[model samples]
Target chain A: MTDVASPHTDPEQKRGLFETLEIDTRLLGMIGAFILICLAFTWYTDGRFLSARNIFNLTIQTVSVAIMATGMVFVIVMRHIDLSVGALLALCSAVMGLLQVRILPQYGIPLGSPLIAPIAMAAGILTGAAVGALNGWLVGYQGVPAFIVTLGGLLIWRNVGWYLTSGQTLGPLDPTFLKFGGSEGTLGVTLSWIIGALAAAAAVWAVWRARQVKERHEFPVKPIGAEVALSVVIAASILGFVYFLNSYLIPDARLKRMFEARGEVMPEGYTEGFGLPISVVVVIVVAIVMTIIALRTRFGRYIFAAGGNPDAAELSGINTRWLTVKVFALMGILCGLSAVIAQARLQNHTNDLGTLDELRVIAAAVIGGTALSGGVGTIYGAILGALIMQSLQSGMAMVGAEAPFQNIVVGVVLALAVWLDIQYRKRTGALK
Target chain B: MTIETKIDPRGTPLVEMRDISISFGGIRAVDHVSIDLFPGEVVGLLGHNGAGKSTLIKCLSGAYHADAGDIFINGEQAVINNPRDARGYNIETIYQTLALADNLDAASNLFLGRELVTPMGFVDDGAMEAETRKIMARLNPNFRKFKVPVAALSGGQRQSVAIARAVYFNARILIMDEPTAALGPHETQMVAELIQELKREGLGIFLIEHDIHAVMKLCDRAVVMKNGARVGTVNVAEVTDDDILGMIILGKKPPQAV
Candidate 1:
C-alpha cells in the first residue's frame, strides 16, 4: 500500500516567506508591480511623478472608478458583467446636478442651503438604484443576458443624461456637494494623522482577534514573530502614507487668499498640507465595506457558490434569482455613489462625464484578479487594479504620450495581466 | 441470497409520497408513483436509465415539484415547494453528481444555505471549519484537505463531503442517489458501513442504485421502477437477485413479491 501525502502535511518541508507570512502571493505581486510602475514614472518625469502632490491627485483620481470596481468584483464573481456603470454614473450625476442647480432652487431652496446637497445625493442614489433594479429584473426574471441588458442601459442612460441636461453642462453645484470632489475638501494634517493612528490600531487589533479566534478553535496559529512583523508593516505603511500626503504643503498664495476671504491677515510662514481628500476617504470607506461584505456576508458566499456551480447552489435551496437582482442593485448603488464623486470633482454634470469609464472599471476589476469566468475575486484587488489603471493613464499623460498611445498601453497591459494571471493559476493548479 | 431482518410494519411511516407525478415539457417523467419508508429502514430504488427512479426521488428531495401528489412526513402532510422546504422537514439529499460548489471549501459547501452566523450576522467561518473538522474526523478520518476548494479533492473525497453534509444536518430522512458511484471499493465499503450506522441511529434512507448485488446486501426492501412507474417492491429476503433483476429489466413483479 502506498501513502499519498497531502500538501499541508509535509511537516519537514521548509516554507517560503510568503507562505509563512500567509500573504496572498498575487497581492504581493500587485504591490510590487505598482511600486515598479511608480518608480518608472518617477524616472521618466524627472521625479515630479512621485511628488506628494501627484500622489494625492492620483488617489483622488482613482476614487470614482475604484468605487464602481469594488461592486464589479461581486458582479463578475457571480458570472455577470455590468456594462452600464459609466452610463449610470452619468445619469446619476445629471440627476444630482439638476436637483442641486435647477430643481432645488426653483422650489425656493437656496443653492447654499444645507438641505440641497443631501437632497440631491438622495435623489441621485435612488435613481441609480431604481435603474439598477430594472436592469437586474430584466436579467434575472426576464431571462435577458446581462451583457445585452447592460449594453442597452449604456446607450439609453447616456442619452437620458444628455437629454436631462439639454446637451449643456450643469454645474456650479452646491459647495457642500462639491466637497466630495478631491481637492475642494480634505482632511487636514492633524485629522489625517489621527485617522492613520486609528487605522493602524484597528489593523493590529484585527490580527490579534483573528489569532484569538483560531486559538479558541484549537487551530494552528501563525508564528508570533510573523504576526508582529505583519502588524509593524501594516502600521508603518499607513502612517507613511499620512506622512507623505502631509508633505505636500498648501501654497502660500492659496493660504493668503483663504485668509483674505475670512477677513483676516495672513500670518508669516503659515502653511498646512492637504492630508487626505474626501473623495479618497470615500474610496477607502467603500473598499473596506465592500471587502467585509464579500468576506463576511451570506450574500457574498452565495455569489461565489452560485458562480462556482449554479446547479449546486440551486439544489442547496439558494434563491439565486433574487441574489442576482440584489447584486445588480448593489452595483447600481455604487454607481450612484461614484457619480457623486465624479460630478463633485468636475464641479458639473456633462453628457460625457463617465464616457469609457465602464471599460476602465471592468479592466480594473479583472486586473485586480476577479476571474471573468466567475467564482473568484477580491475587493482589495479591485481597488488596487483601479489604482494601477489610473496610474498607467496618468503616468503616460505626464510623460507627454498621446491619448491614443495611452489607451494602447492600457489595453495591452490589461491583456498581459490577465494572461499572466492565467499562467499563475495554471502553475498552481488553481485554474478551474 | 441476503438475510433480511423482519420489521414490524405497525407504526407511522417516516415519509410517504402518495400518487406522485411530475412532467417535463409535457412528458410524464414520473407517473403515479407512490412509496413509503419507515424509521431505521433502507429502501432501495432500482431501475434502468430513464426509468424515473431519479426523477421520483428528486420530488422528495425538493429538486422538482410533483405535478400531482401529497407527501406526508410522520403521517403529517408536508409541503415541499423547494429544496429549502424539504430541508426544513429534516430531509437531505446526496445527489448523484455530488452537487458541490467547486470553488468553495468543504466547510462552505457543507453549509451552503444554512451557514452558522455570529451575533453580528456575519458568517462564522472559523466555527464552521471547526464543526467541519469534527464531522470529517468522524466520517472519514483520512480526509484532511479542509482548506482547499472541493474541486481539488479526489472523487472519493468529494463523495465524503457530500455524505458529511447530509449526515451533519441531523437529517431524519436521507435520499442518496448513487452515493457510491464515484467511490473506490474501500470507500464503497465505508459508505455501506455508514448506511448501517445511520440505520441503527434511526435514519430512514432512500438508496438509489443500479448495482443489484449492493441492493441485495444493503437494502431491507427493494422498490423497482421502470418507465416512470413502480413495478413492485419486495423484501430483500424473499426476492433473490434474479427476481429483482427481472423487476428492473422486464418491469414485472416477481411471483414471490405477489
Candidate 2:
C-alpha cells in the first residue's frame, strides 16, 4: 500500500542502491558461507579440496539431495514437513531393483535390455508417488498432522525397502541406466559451453523483460546499472562453471604417477576431459523447473498464502487442505527422481540406500533460507544449501577427518546457518 | 466507463437475513435477528462487544452458518455453506483483523484465491499489479508500496489493501467489520470517503462499528442490537446519537420496533 517516502520521491528512487540488488542478506550470507567454506577447505587440504576433480565429485554428491530439497522447499513453506523422503527413496529404488532382478526376469525380460531400465525407473518413481499420495490423503483429508504421518511413513517405508531387497544389496544395474549417473554420460566441453551460453542469454532476457514491464506500469524499476551488473555476474558465473568442469580430466591425471610406479603404461586413446556431470545437469533442470513453479504459478502463491495464515487463506476462498495434499504429492514425485539418481550413481540398491537422507534434505532447505516456521523459501536457495552441505562433507573427508567429527561439524554448521537466518529476519523485521 | 453500469437498475434489496439465530456452546450468540440492505444504502450495525452484532454479520458473510434462518439474495433463497459460496454471490467481507496474508505483497493478497492467470496457468503478476495500481489510485491514491509485504504497511495502508481486495472482485454486497477501528483520524477520514464513493456506485454495505460518530456520519440507517437481540432499526435522521446509545446500553426498543 502506501509508503513512508515523500510524495515527490519517485517510486524508483525510494529504494537505496543495495536494496535494488533484490538479493536479500540471507542469500548473500549463504553465498558468503559457500565461498568461505571453499577457501578454508582448499587451504586445509593443500589445494586438493578445490581441485577440479573433487569439485566435480562434490557436485555429483549434492545432486540427489538438491533435487529433493527443491521439493522440500514447497512442503516446508506450506507449513508441513516430510520425514519420509529418505525412506521413500530407498523403498522406490529397491522396488526398481526387485523388478530388475526377480520380477521382470521371471516375465521373460532379459537383463540389460534398454526397455528394462525405463520400466524399472517408472515403477520406482510410481511407487514413491503412490506412497506420497497416501501421506497426503491422511494428512490433508483425514486431518492428521504431517509430522506424525510422515514420521510413521519414515519407519514403514524404510522397512519396506529392506523387505523388498530381502535385507541384501541388489544391483550392478542395467548398463544403460547406469550411464545417466556416471561420467560416460556427461555432456562434453563444447556442449557444456553451449548450454552455459544459452542459460546466460535467458537470464539477460528475463531481466530485460522484467524491466520493460516495470517501466510500462510506472512501478519502481531496478536501475539499469544494477541490472547490467547482475547480468554480467550471472554470465561470468555460468562461463566460469563450464571452464572449471572442462579443466578436470577424466581417469584423473593425478593418478598417472601411481600407474607409472606400478610399471603400467597409460592406456592409449583414453577419453580426456570430464565435461559436465550428468547428475549436475539433472539437478539444474529440476531446480529451474521447481523455481518456476514456486515463483510463477497460481498454485505456488496459494502455498505461501495458506502457509502464512490458513484462516485468512480459507476466508479468501482457498482450499487450504487440498493445497496441502497437492504440495505433498509434488514432494513425492521429487523423491522418486532422487531415487533413480541415487540407485544409478551407486549401481545398487541396498537396505541402507538413502538412509538418513531426509535430515540432509531438510538441513539444506533450512540453511538455504527456507524458514522452518513456513511461508518463506526458494528452490535455488535450497539447492545452494545442499551444495554447501555436501562441500563440507567432501572437504572434511578429503582432509582425513573422522566420520564422527565430520558429523559434528556439519551439525554445527546447520545450526549456525539457521541462527544466522533468524538474525537476518529480525534485522529486517521480516519475522512475524 | 463509470461504475454505474455494474449496479442493478431494479429497486430491490440486495440481501435479507430473516429470523437468523445461532448458538455456541449453549450460549445463544444471535437470536432471531433480521436485517435488510437495499442497493446504494450504508446500514450500520451498532452493538457492544459480544452483543452478537458480529455474529449476525458473519452469517451473512458466510463465515458462520445460522442455525435457524433463511437468507435471501435478490428475493431468492441462497445457500452459503462456506466462504466460496459467499463469493459466488459476489459478497466480500473485510474482517476486523483485516485477514491478509502478512508475508505477501499487496497485489498477491489482493488476488489470493481468485488469481488471474495466463492461459498457461501461470499467475500473470504484471497484469495483476497494473490492475491493483488502477484500483488503489481510485480508492487510496497515495498507495504506492506495491512490492513490500502488507505486514510492513501502516494500519491505514493495510486497511486500504483489504478494502481494495474486496472492491476489486465485483462484490455487490460488502461487509466491513470495524474498517477504521485501528486507524488514525486522517486514515479514518480516508476510509469514510472510500465508503461514500462505494455508496455512490450503488453497492450495499454493512458497516459494523462501535464509533457512534462514524455511524452518524456515514450510515443512512442504524440497526442496534443488545444481548443477542435486536433493539430497533432506525433511520439516522430519525434518531440522535444518544437514542442509539440508549438502545445499545439498556436493551430498550424504540416505538417502531415495539
Candidate 3:
C-alpha cells in the first residue's frame, strides 16, 4: 500500500503461481456444460419444467436434499462427510413424533394440539443437534475420520428411531404444526422458504460486505469482476423468478375479499398469490446462507485452510479441532430442519422417514464440486448439484424411466462430477 | 522519587532472550543461548546447518517454548509461551516460507488472523487496503499496489508483506530467517533496503542467515553458534566473514578461529 514496488521481481510469476494453484479453468467449462444440461432438461421436459408451478414444485421437492447437501458441502470441504443425515433425520423426526404422541398426551395436550407439534419439532431439532455434536466431538477431539463416525451414527441413529417408535409410523399431528413446515403464507408461498431465503440473503450480504472491506483496506483482495458477475447472475435469476411469479394473475383471497366488499364474488381456486412451498424456500435459503458462511467468515476460511493444508493452518494459529466440531454441529442443525420438512411433506412421522437421504444429499454435494478429500467447494455449487440430481430424476421419471434406471443415471452423473473435480485439481495443482 | 527506569529511550534493546534453552526428544536443540537486540541495529545469528540459530530464534517468536530461559521486552521479562504471546510482545518471525497465503493480498497477509474488522462485524477491507498502502509507503514508497495476492508479489514485495505483518502488529523485535534466500541480487538488495527502513523505525532485528556476505554487510553485531552452543558474540565491525565462517566451522571465538 505504501510503497509502489512489489517484493517479487517477477510479478507475473507470482500471479501465475496462484492461477496454477487455486482455481481450475476447466471448472468454468464444466459450469457452462452444466448450464447446457439444465437448458436441455427444461427443453425436453417440454414447458412443464419451465412453468412457474413445476419449478416451484421442484423447489419444494428438493428442499430436504438441498439443505442437507449444503451442510455436507462444508463437511466435504473440510475433507469429511456425514453419511448420517438420513438416519439422523429419521431419528429426530421419530423422537419428535414420540414426544408428541406420548409425552404431550401425559400433559393433557392432544395429539393435534398446537403446543404438542411445536414441542415435537423443537425436540426433533434438539435431537439432531445433539447427534451432530456427538459426531463433531468424536471426530474433532477423538481423532476419528468423520466418514466413519457419521456413518456409524447414521446406522445407529436409524435403529434408535425405529426402536423408539416400536417400528411404527406415528401421526395425525396438530394442524398448527403445519405452519412450521407444511404451511405456506397466505401469499401463496411457503413461510419456511421465505425465512430461509431471508437468512441466506443476509449471509450473502455479510460476505459481500466483508469482501468489500478486505478490498478497501487494501488487503490481498481477490478480483471483484468474477464475483460481481456471479452475484449478478444469482440476483438476476432470483429477480427473474420473483418478477415472473408476480406477473402471473394470482387469485388472492384478499383481492377477492376486496371485490366482495365491492359486492363482487371471489374467484374459486389456489391461484396467483405470492406462494411457494415452505420447504422449497427453507432449503434454498439455508443452502445459500451456509455457503456464504463457508466462504466469508473465519469459520469458512478455517474449513478451506484445513482442507488445503492442516499443518499450515495449525501453525497459523487456527483451532482446527473447534472448526471441525462446529461444522458437524452446523450440519446437524440443518439435518434437523430438513427432518421437519420431510415429516410435514408426508404429513406423518414414519420410522422410514429420511432413509437414503444421506445418499442423495452427499451425492448432490459431490456432484456440485465438493471433494471427499477436502478443501474445494461452494454452496452454490451444491445447489447446482442438487438441482442436477432432481432434474435428472424428474426428467427420467417423466419419460417413464424406472427407479433402477434413474439410480443408474444418477450414479453415472455422480462419477462424471468426480472425474471433473479430478481434472479441475490437475489443472489447478490442488490435487496430486 | 520514581526511578523512571534509566534506559536509553531510542537506543533501547527491543528484545533480549537470556539463557534460552529448548529440548526436543531429550536432545537440547538450543542450549543456554542468549542474545540482545537494540533498536536501529541488525544482529546476525550465524551457525552450521543444525547450529541452533533457528531453534533459539523460534523460542523468542513463541514457535517453541524454551525448556529453560526467559525472554525480556524493554528490559522486562516476558513469558512468550505461544505465537500469540510473541505477537503480544510485538515480536514477529518471518520464515523462509514467508508464511504468506498466496491467495491473500499484502494487506491480508499483514493483518492475517488479526484483521481490521468493520464496525458492522466484517473485515473492513477498505481500511485494510488503506493501512497497507500507508505501511508500504513508509517501507518502500515505490512498492506496487494491486498485488491482488501475495503470490503475485515479487520476492522483495512478498518479503515486504511478511515484514509488514510484523510491523503492523507493532512488533519491536523482528526475526528474519534467511529473508533474502533464493532471491536474485536485485531482489536481495530490495530486501536489504526494506531492512534498513525497518531499522529506521527503531526496530530491533535478528537476521538468521547462512550468507556471511550478507552478515558482513548488514549486521551491527554477529553472534555465532554451533551444535546447540554459542561460540561468541562479536561486533560485526571487528569481525570478518572469514572470522565468522571459521567460528561456524570450529565453534569458537573469531580470535581463537583466526
Candidate 4:
C-alpha cells in the first residue's frame, strides 16, 4: 500500500509537462485558442488588430459581460441558468440614470455632487438584489423551476426599464460615475506600474507561502525549480501586461484638451499612456475576489458540493434551498455592477441597454469550460470566456464581416467549443 | 472471533423510535413501527424491498419527518427536523446509495459540509487532505486515488469513503443502510471487523440488512418488518435462523418470540 501511494507523493516519478507545471490543461487550451484568434485577426487586419489601443479597447469591451459571467459560472455550476441578467442590467441602469438625473436633484443633491453616484449606485444594486431574492424565492422555496422564473424575469425587467425611462434615453450622468465606463478614467502609467509591481510581488509570495504551508502540514511539496519557474512566469505575465497597456500613448489632441480643461499650458512633447482603464481594473478586482470566493470560502465549497450531488449535500446537512437564494442574489448583484460599467461606458442609459448580453455572457461561461451539467467551473475560466467572445466579435467586425455573418460564426463557434470540451472530457475520462 | 455478550437490553435504550409513522401522498410507507437500540449493540433491520425498512430508518436519520410518534435519545425526547438536527444529537447515517458528490475528490467529499478551515475562515485544503490520508490509511489502506473525484473510484472505494465519513465524526448512534452491499468479500470482512471495533467502543448501531447471515453474525437483536409494520424483534442468541427467515418471508412471529 505504501508503495502504491508513493508515486503520488514522490517527486522522482516521471511526470508530464502539464503535471510538472501544475497547470490545468483546459485553461492552457483556452489560452492557446485566444492567442490563435488574436494572431489570425492581426494577420487579417495587416498588423492593426493587435495594436495596444485595440487591446485596451478589447479589455474595456469585455468588462461588463465578463463581470456578470463570473456570477453566471456559479449559477451554471449549480445547474441553474440566469436569463434575466441582461434585462436586469437594463433595469438597474434605468434606475441609476433616473436617480442621478431626476430623483437626486429633486432631493436637493445636485448631479455633480459626490453623494449622487454612490447613492444611485446603491439603489440600483439594492433593486437588483431584491429582484434576485424574489427570483430565488420562487425557485428555491416556492419550488418553481429556475428557467421559468428567470425567463419571466427577462420579459418583465426589460419592460420595467422601458416604462421607467418612458422610451427616452437618460444620461449625461455624473462625471465620477462615468469614470467606470473605461477610457474616461485611467490609473495612469506610474500608478499602473506600481500596482503591477505589487501584484507581481503578491503572486510570488503566494507561491512561496503555499509551499511553506504544504511543508508545515507534512504534505508533499513541489520541486523548488518548478515553484520558482511558476512564480517567475506569473510575475512576468503581470509586468508584461502592464508594459503592453503603457505602450498605448494617449492621442496628442486628447492630451492638449485635458491640459486646457485644467487651465494649464501643455508642456512640449509631454506624453502619457492610459495604462489601465478603471473599468478593466474593476474586472481585475472582481476576478480576484470571485476566485477567492470560489476556492477558499465555506460558501463556495457548499456551492460545488451541492452542485455535484444535491442529495449528498443535503444529507451532509447543507441548507441547499438557502444556498440557491444566495447564489441568485449574488448573480443579481453582479448584474447591477455590470450595469454601472455599461451605462457609464455609453454615457447614458438607453431603454435597450444590455440587449442580447445574456446570451453572450452564457456563451462566455460555457466556452470558458463551465459544465452546464453542474459541479464544475472556475472564475478565471468565465472571464477568459468573456474575453474570447468579445475578441471574436471585435475581430470579425474589424475585418468588415457582416453583422449577421458574425452572429452565425459566433453561434457555430459556441457549438464547436462545447463539442470540443466534451471530447476533451471524454478523452481524459473525466466524464462517463 | 469472540462475540461480546455484554448487551443489557433492560436499561435505557441509546435510541428509541416509538410508534413512528410516515406517509407519502396517500400511501403509508412506514406504518406504526417501533424499534429501540441499546448502547454498544447492533440492531439488524430486515424486511422485503417495500417493507419500509429504509423509510423507517430515514425518519430516525431526519431525512424524512415522521407523520406521528417521537424519538428519544438517551431517554430524552429528541426533536429532529432535518439532517442537521440529527447530527446535533451525535447521530450519523451512512446512506444506502453512499451519498457522495461524484465531482469532488475523496478528501473534499469526506469534508463536504463540515470542512476544516484555517483561522482566517479559509478552507484548509492541506489539513483536510492530511486528515483524510490518516483516516483512509486506517479504513482502506489501499485507497491511493485521493486526488481524483469519487466518480472515478470503484464501488468498494466509494463505499469506504461513505463509511469513513460516518465514522470520522464521532457518532454515538450510527445508522448504516446496506453499507456492505457494494463491497467485495474482503471489504465486507473489513466492515464486519470495523463494526466489531465500533461496537466495543460503546457506539450503538442500527444495521439495515437483507442478508440474514450478516445479521446472525453481527447483530445482538434482529428486528423484522413486513409491509411497513414490525413483525417481531428477537434476541439472536435464542432465535434460530429459520425462525427469523419465517418472520421475514411469512410476516409471522415465531412461537418463542410470541
**10 residues in a row with least lDDT, candidate 1 chain A:** A1-10
Q: What TM-score number comes out for model 1?
A: 0.96
CAPRI classification of candidate 2: acceptable
Candidate 2 runs further than 4 Å off: A1-14, A252-270, B1-11, B23-28, B226-229
- Clashing residue pairs, candidate 2? none
Interface DockQ of each model = 0.48, 0.42, 0.19, 0.48
Better of 2 and 4 by TM-score: 4
Number of the candidate with higher DockQ, 1 or 3: 1
Q: Report the C-alpha displacement of residue A197, candidate 3, in angstroms.
A: 13
lDDT of 1 at A372: 91
Decreasing DockQ order of the candidates: 4, 1, 2, 3
Ranking by lDDT: 1, 4, 2, 3
Question: Taking the tens digit of each residue's C-alpha lDDT, what string does model 1 give over A1-432?
Answer: 012224464432555666656788999999999999999999999999999989988988999999999999998988989999999999999999889888999998878999999999999999888998888888888989999999999999989998988988997889999999998888899999999899999999999999999999998788999999989999999999889888888889888998999999998978889888888888888988888888899999999999889899999999988989989999999999999999999998888998999999999999999999989899999999999999999999999999899999999989998998999887655675
Candidate 2 positional error at A386, Å:
0.8
Each prediction's whole-model lDDT (CA):
0.90, 0.86, 0.74, 0.89
Chain B TM-score against the true chain B, candidate 4:
0.94
Per-residue error (Å), model 3, residue A424:
5.9
Q: Over 4 Å off in model 1, which ranges?
A: A1-17, B1-8
With candidate 3 superimposed using the best TM-score fit, by how many Å does residue A193's alpha carbon deviate from the native? 13
